[model samples]
Target: MEDHANSRHKKTVQPVAKARQEVYVLRDLKEYLGESLLIIFSVLLALVLTEFINKQHEKSQTKELLNNIKEELKKNKQAEQEQYVYQQGILKRIDSVLRDPGLQKKVLTDGTFHLDYLAPEGVSLHDLSRVAWQVAQSHDITPKLEFKLVEMLTDIYDQQARIDKIEDKEAAVFLNYESRKPENIRETLILMRDNYHGWAFDRAPALIKKYDAAIKEIDRDL
Candidate 1:
């Protein structure tokens, strides 16, 4: 009878010990899982914060580029305005010569024809600046700007390039030229920026209109 009682006690105690062991193992697993999740959450938060900071920095740099371009445009506009007036003066003088028969005959017949016109200056060019725009493009900041704004910038620069080409076409005539011949002088005078449609002059109303429109758009954006 004692032996049977001892066997029953042993069976009850063994089950109780096994149950406690299982509970302890489950608690350890929960603790491990909690730590892993916390670590993952922390790493994700850091990555998100780093990305946000980088975006902000890039946005600020793009803005600075636009403002620099705006200032540059303002200077170029002024330079073009002055160039237009000077070139118009030369064109009007040439027109006066064109209407005069005596002057035309003298220009046709005379070399060394003692021109009464004093200090016939060479072709006047617009000092337009593309530095700021070039820098922005090189840095790839233009993609961040509004699409319409980029188009406007391209148009203005293209117009500037056209004007430069006109000036360059006639540059050979006046580059260190020392001829006092009346025929040559008259030809030079004729080609010295007849009008915006011709070469070297920016007096065309259309060109100024474009500049004004660009300035207005930039102002609105700012």
Candidate 2:
């Protein structure tokens, strides 16, 4: 009778132990699922923050480049305005020199021939001067003279070549020059400048001297 009772009690205890094991396994599964979800959320949040930072940095770089371009454009416009002003001053001075009766007579009859192309037409010197100042901040009479000098130099250089056959000794000296390009004829000009008094016996060199002065002024200002 006692053995039978003992067996019955063991059977009841075995089912209870099995139920406890099932409850513990379910609790552990729930904890593992919660931990996995938390890890995934953290990874996604970090990716979003990194993306936001990258986009902000790109936007800043783009803005900086645009600002730089604007500054460059502004500087270029200002420089152009200044150049226009200087050219206007030069035009005014040229018109004045072109109009003076005495100067015109000297230009034509004296055979110095500086204003051969500048005709007596268009606006007066005063008006042009005003216009020039309105356009540019500075007056520069040098460019007008520089343009004329370039033409005169070209003519003078041509004359030298023509005289080569007539004066072989002088031509030989010219040929031996380091560079005889028309542009390099400033060397010959300096020689003439040094011996101006002796050379003036033949032709009035006022135009040439004025041309030289204009070039010097331009160089100094520019």
Top of the candidates by lDDT: 1
Model 1, span 160-192: residue lDDT tens:
777766556655544425434544665655654
Model 2 per-residue lDDT tens digits across residues 1-222 = 999988878844454455444444446777989999999999999999999998787556544433333343334334334433433443454455445555434433422333222313211111101222222213232243345534543443333233222223323333444424443344532332232222221122332343344344434433
Residue 19's C-alpha lDDT in candidate 1? 47
TM-score for candidate 2, residues paired by index: 0.29
Cα-based lDDT for every prediction:
0.67, 0.39
TM-score of each: 0.69, 0.29
Instruction: State candidate 1's TM-score.
Output: 0.69
lDDT of 1 at 30: 79
For model 1, state the Cα shift of residue 210 in Å. 2.1
RMSD of each: 9.9, 20.8
Q: Considering only N, C-alpha and C atoms within 3 Å, which residue pairs clash in candidate 2? A: 85-136
Off by over 4 Å in 2: 1-28, 84-222
